[model samples]
Target chain A: MTEIKFWRGFFSILLVISLLFFIFHVWAVILPFAFGIIIAYLVNPLVDNLAAMGLKRSRVVLILYLILLGAGIMLAMTLIPSLIKEANAAVKELPAYTTAIDDLITKANGEIQKFIKPIFKSKSDVIAIPFAAQKFIDSLIPQLPQKILGVAHAGLWIIIIPFVSFFALSHGKSWIDIIFDSTPSEYVENLLGFMAELNATLGGYVRGLIIESLCVGLLTIAGLWAMGIKGAVLLGVITGLVNFVPFMAPLLGGGLALLTAYFQFKSFSVLVGIALLFIGVRLFDDFVLIPFVVGSSVHLHPVIMVFAILAGVEVAGFIGLVFAIPVAVVIKVFLSVALRHRKERLMFRHEHVYS
Target chain B: MNLSFYRLIKKLFNDENHGEEMSFLRGVPIFFGLSSHQLGRIMQAIQKRKYYAGEILFQEGQIGKAVFIIKTGRVELVKNVPEGGEPRLLGNLGPGQIFGEMALLEHRPRTASARVVEDGEIFLLYTATLEALLKNHPAIGVKLMRNIAVMLSALLRRTNQELENQKKS
Candidate 1:
């Protein structure tokens, strides 16, 4: 028994480690599937509502798919030339950013040496830091090949996911029925309860999210436009997409935008305006929109939200960040159902008296 | 003679031919002790609504924004469940049964789907009204919870008895 217990414990840990590693390993390939699920979840309520109104779920899914595809095509048609132009422009200007960065680093190093060498009385120490940093960056660049491969895998996955989701949504009812019928009666009820709760949580989340993302995107565009930045739409899309990752997204997007603004405008005032815009966008999200929209429905604390994000990032890099909360919500749904049933059992009554 | 007098009042209140609706509050235990004036206040707040046969009374897992009381006709509780299998019937509910009481304290999602078996009239009580009622009559919340506890416990006991009988058979 002792030996079996040891082995069981060891295997459990191993199983967890393997599962985590596999999730990370296949994340690039799995990202599109996860994205597809999120998309289906976002679109499901609309589709279901429409379906309830005499339209077929399949037809609804088809219509939504078309809208998404048409929108993507339109975006590509509208933005590709400008995007290409920007790409070329960025490539052309890449050297300038690099040069500016290098100059900045060199100037900072010069100041450090001036201040530190005499105080430390060590001539070589001040020179050592830059050389080490530069060497580290050079070493890291070679590892980009795997990351590039991951991006390619992600692209392939994205292309196939929508078609898969359409099929999932259309045939979902029968598939759902089959799943429910296969379970034992009691378990079926539990599972049914779970699905119902899952639907509610995901529905609330997706509805809240789509509205929030659009708000963030539009606000970001307005802010950037007011700040006199070029490519406001593009920056807005980046902001919206990044906002999906919680707190880090807006900052990252804003910082990237700021870098471009600094380079393109070369105006300190423009830089300040850009910074203020990001802060304003974040504040809007934190205060007015979040309270009214997402509100207290999910009831996850900010600290728990942060921890979930970190864990998600650790296990699946970026995709985990997107999925962890809903996944937690599902577990919560299960626990809640189990507890409700348990509560009933605990409060067992021989007689049901009426008021 | 005294029993007959109590019966007369009960018949008068319970009779549909008297041209008055069964005030929904009387069916719910917590509201029994309320003065007629207080019950009248609750009745004024209610939205009397009707549903036809096959019409959804309420969907399972929907956010319970209102409390529903079934005054007449039967309701079948179903769950539109899709796991990965065929969906199963959760249970059935009937007249005088309260469907949305589980979510009285908060907007807990409806656990079971309900649809009218025949044309049915129900009194829809909003959560806001309940909140106000709780404020005005502080004991109502506790009484309401106790009523729910009793209902839930009764369901468990009946199920238990059924299982034991099945085993014996």
Candidate 2:
């Protein structure tokens, strides 16, 4: 029996490691399906609501698809053209922006050198920040075409995601039923409890994140357009996408907005205004959007959250970062449930002995 | 109507015996007085599973997490005797009967064990799912809780009456 237990433990560990390894290796291939699953999960509550009203699940899914198709077509006709035009304009002005960036870096480097001159014995000892910045910009310009081409390659995802999500939305319940049916009767209750807890934790968070990002994106676009900033649409979209990563929204979004404002308008006041706008958005997000939308769905400690994000980055780069919080939430819920089950079992044993 | 139109209409509205399921749920004691729509919502949270004869649904003294409603099954409630002989048979339950319902009120040890007497299907409503529903839809929750309270009160009164009779004898 001891040998059997030892082999079981060993195999479990081995299985987990193998699964992780497989995921790491094939993540790029799996990304589109992962996105489909997330979309299905996000849309499930609406489907459930309508289904509870006695609508056929398949018909409801078909109706939802029709609505989404119409919306997508509308967006394609209107938003896509404007976005493309803005992107083309930005690419054309890249050289001018590079020059402006170089000039700014040079000026900043001069001031830094002046400040550090007394500390350093020789001028050569001082770092050339402007040179490094220029080199980095030069390196990035050559990669632009390739990066754009890579994005174009991902057009296949447009077809695959909805196809996968449609089936998932319609059939997700049956899949869950199959799992429940396969589980031993003794553990079925525990499985259900675990699922309930997981849904309670992650469902609200995922849905809230999407809504929050959309609001932020729309707000950013409106604010930038009001200020007559160039590339407002593109920048807003970028800002919204970056908002998924904690603490990145303001840093990357604000920095890009400031640069574009300064280079285009060449005014300190515009840069300051852009900075103030981001701060306002961040405040609004923290106070209103998060509180009302996300509520307290995830209860991970801030420290643990940071560590999970870092580990995610180390494991799978950007995808890892995007999924880190949800993964951490799952782990936390699993541990809590498992520990509770163990505690209950021990307590039951104690009671039985006394009885 | 043309055959294609008839088929389309049928496809659109046919939610496979949903009426039958709702009617069955309406017969449940805890769900008494709930509207058809309310019962439908509750049915969305219920999970149906099949159990074979001789299978244990739950054990005595184990923590309860879900209430089981027999859809088409015979279940027996059994309790362990203090003297450690054969377990005492509490009662047999059939379709529409529910067990482990106290778990919904609180996470506590089940008072008796439930075992499947015949192979059939049962519906499981997890406490967490019910709590979520209660939080989200209070009207349904109010009716369900009130019915549960009434049932418990009747049980208490019956027990009290039995105790009085035994004392008199």
Candidate 3:
């Protein structure tokens, strides 16, 4: 019996490692299906509710897709033209903004050298700082076309996502049921408990994130537009997209908005106003949106959360960063459940021996 | 177009006997007072499975995580004897009877082992799923908990009587 258990454990570990290896190797191909599964998971409760009302699952999914398609078209019609115009204007004014930034950097470099002269022995060391900064900016411009092409390629997957999600929503439950049927009855209850816990944690986090991002994005658009900032819609959408990663929204979104405001108006007051708007939005998000919307879905320590985000970026770039917290939550739940089960088994054995 | 759409949907996704299932669930003691709408919500959380005769649903001393409702089967609850004697038969449960219900209230070792006496289908409701349902729909939760409390109180009274009779004899 002990030998059987040992082999079972070993094989289970081997299977899991093989699965992870397969996923890692085919990540690019799996991206769309992964996104579809996520979307299906998020929208499942509504589908289940309607299905419970006697509607067929496939029918419900089809109806939902139609509604979403209609909404998406309406939104695009309203928002796309203004966004394109703003983007075009920004591209046209890029050279002038670059010159202005260069001038500002030179002025700042002079002040920086004056302050650090007493500490540094040579002027060359001080000049190196601004030179490296300029070199970095120059390097990024050349890579813009490649990055844009990558984004466009990813955009093609948007069509495939809904197609994949439709089947997933309709057939996902039966797929789970098949697994349940195959599992030994002894471990079925444990599997059900694990799945239930996972559903609660991941479902709450994903739904809460969408709502929070939407609220933050709308607030940003309103604030920037009120202040007559250029490209308010474009900047707000980017903010919402990057809000998937913690702290990226404010840093990237706010920085871009500040630069735009400075270039467009060239007023210190306008720059300060843009800065204040971002600060206010961040404060609101931390105090109100997070507590009310996200609540306690994720309970990782702040340090661990930051580490997970960094590790995610290191592993899979932006996609990894987006999935980091959910993946961490799954690992935490799996370990806790396995450990608890082991402890219970040991305690049971101990009681039996005593008896 | 509407008729064709309906026909296409019906052809693509065949309808199940949801009405029959809902009526069956409505007869269960815990769900006795629930309306069709509330019962529909519960149906979403419950998992149905078929068991063969002589299959062990769960063993005594194992931690219970889900409550099982016999939809169409005979189940026998047995207790293991400590002195290496034959196991004692606790009771025979039939269709509409629930077992492992204590799991819904708390996570503890099951007091008796449940085995299927006849081939039939059963519905399993995990405690976490029930908790989610209760949290989302408090009205159903209140009704279900009240029925469970009433059933438990009756069981306690019966057990007390049994103990008194044993003492008198």
Candidate 4:
């Protein structure tokens, strides 16, 4: 019996290792599939409502697809061109930005040298820190193709996402039922309770965050444009997309905006204005948007949330960073449910023994 | 041209399999006073599951998140066992009858255990899904809440009469 148990544990570990290996290798495919799942999850409630109105699931899916297609076309026609134009402009302005940044660094170094020269007896004794800006550029130049390839891969998956999501939304009920059906009868009720809790919390949180990100992105674009900031559109998109990452995203966005504003106008007031805009946006997000839109779904500690995000970045780069918080919530909820079940079982056993 | 357009629209919205599910939902009492359209909406939130005889659906004191409706099954609603005694069978539920209903109304533990007496299918109306539906369609939420109130009142009246009879005896 001990040997049997040992083998069971060993095989379980083996199985887990193999699964992780599979996930690691197929992350490229997995990312698109994960996106599809997210889309399906977000759209499912709407689909269910439509289906409840006597519309066939297939027909409802088709209608959703058509609506999505129309929206995509509209975006392609209107937003895409402007976004592309801005992106190209940003790319063209990159060299000048880098040069300015280099010059700024050099000026700061000279000032530091002047300040420290008095402390040192000889000029050679003072450490002359040289900025390796060229090395940074050279490294980035080689990685440029890989980054473009990644973007192209993402673009391809964007086309496939709708199809995957359509099927997921249409058959979501049956799929959930199928999964629950396979569980042992004794644990089914407990599992269902867990799933319902997960659905309510995680699903609502994700949908809310996506909407929040879009709102932040749009607000950034409009604010920057009104201020006549260069690459406003591109900066806005970056800000909005990054806004999903919580504290890190806003800081990154604000820092980029400040740097750009400093480079372009080179005025302290403009930089301060840009900073104030982000501060206002953050205030609005915290007070109004998060309350109305996101609610208090993600009950994570700030320290834990930051740690998970850093770990995620280490593991899977950008995608990891994006999904870290939601994944942590899922794990936390699942463990809590399991612990509750174990406690209940132990209590039951104790009661039976007393009886 | 009109006929083609009508056909296209029909093909767009109609599902043949929805008929059985729709009819089943219409019969559930909590779902009473709801229109066919409303019933169809409730149907979306319901999940159907099959259980064999002697399988426990839920245990007494276990937290319930969904109300179960018997679609094609017999379920024994049992009270908790006394020390060194068998579980007291409260009643059996057949097709169209519902149990674990307070699960839909509130987040609370089950007062009685539900165990399958025969191999059959049951539909579950999860509270979260129902909450989502209510949020989206306030009218349906109002109707369902009213149904639950009425059902509870009737149950209380019956229990009161039973208690009064016992007192007289």
Candidate 2 lDDT, tens digit per residue, A10-40?
Answer: 9999999999999889987788998898899
What TM-score, computed on C-alpha atoms, does each candidate reach? 0.60, 0.93, 0.91, 0.88
lDDT of 1 at A331: 61
The CA lDDT at A89 in model 3 is: 92
Clashing pairs in 3: none
Clashing pairs in 1: A177-B85, A177-B86, A178-B85, A178-B86, A179-B84, A179-B85, A180-B85, A181-B86
> Lowest summed lDDT over 10 consecutive residues: which window, candidate 1 chain A?
A346-355
lDDT of 1: 0.66
Q: Which regions in candidate 3 have their CA more than 4 angstroms from the true location? A: A118-124, A131-134, A141-145, A344-355, B1-16
- Give the per-residue lDDT of model 1 (tens digit) for B30-127: 45565554554455445555556786655555545566677777777765444525445765666666766665666555666677777876666666
Please give the ranking of all candidate structures by lDDT, highest first, separated by commas: 2, 3, 4, 1
What value does the TM-score of chain B take for model 1?
Answer: 0.70
- Whichever of 3 and 4 has more lDDT, that candidate is 3
Pairs with backbone N, CA or C atoms under 3 Å apart (clashes), candidate 2: none
Query: For model 3, how does the per-residue alpha-carbon lDDT over B70-136 read when each residue is reduced to its tens digit?
Result: 9998999998878868988989999989888888998777888889889998899998888878877
lDDT of 4: 0.81
Our model 2 lands, by Cα RMSD against the true structure, at 2.7
- Poorly placed runs, candidate 1 (over 4 Å): A1-30, A123-148, A230-234, A299-307, A321-355, B1-169
Measured with C-alpha atoms, the lDDT of residue B90 in candidate 2 is 81
Q: What count of clashes does model 2 give?
A: 0
Predicted model with the maximum DockQ:
2
Model 2 DockQ class: medium
At residue B58, give the lDDT of candidate 2. Answer: 85
Ranking according to TM-score, highest score first: 2, 3, 4, 1
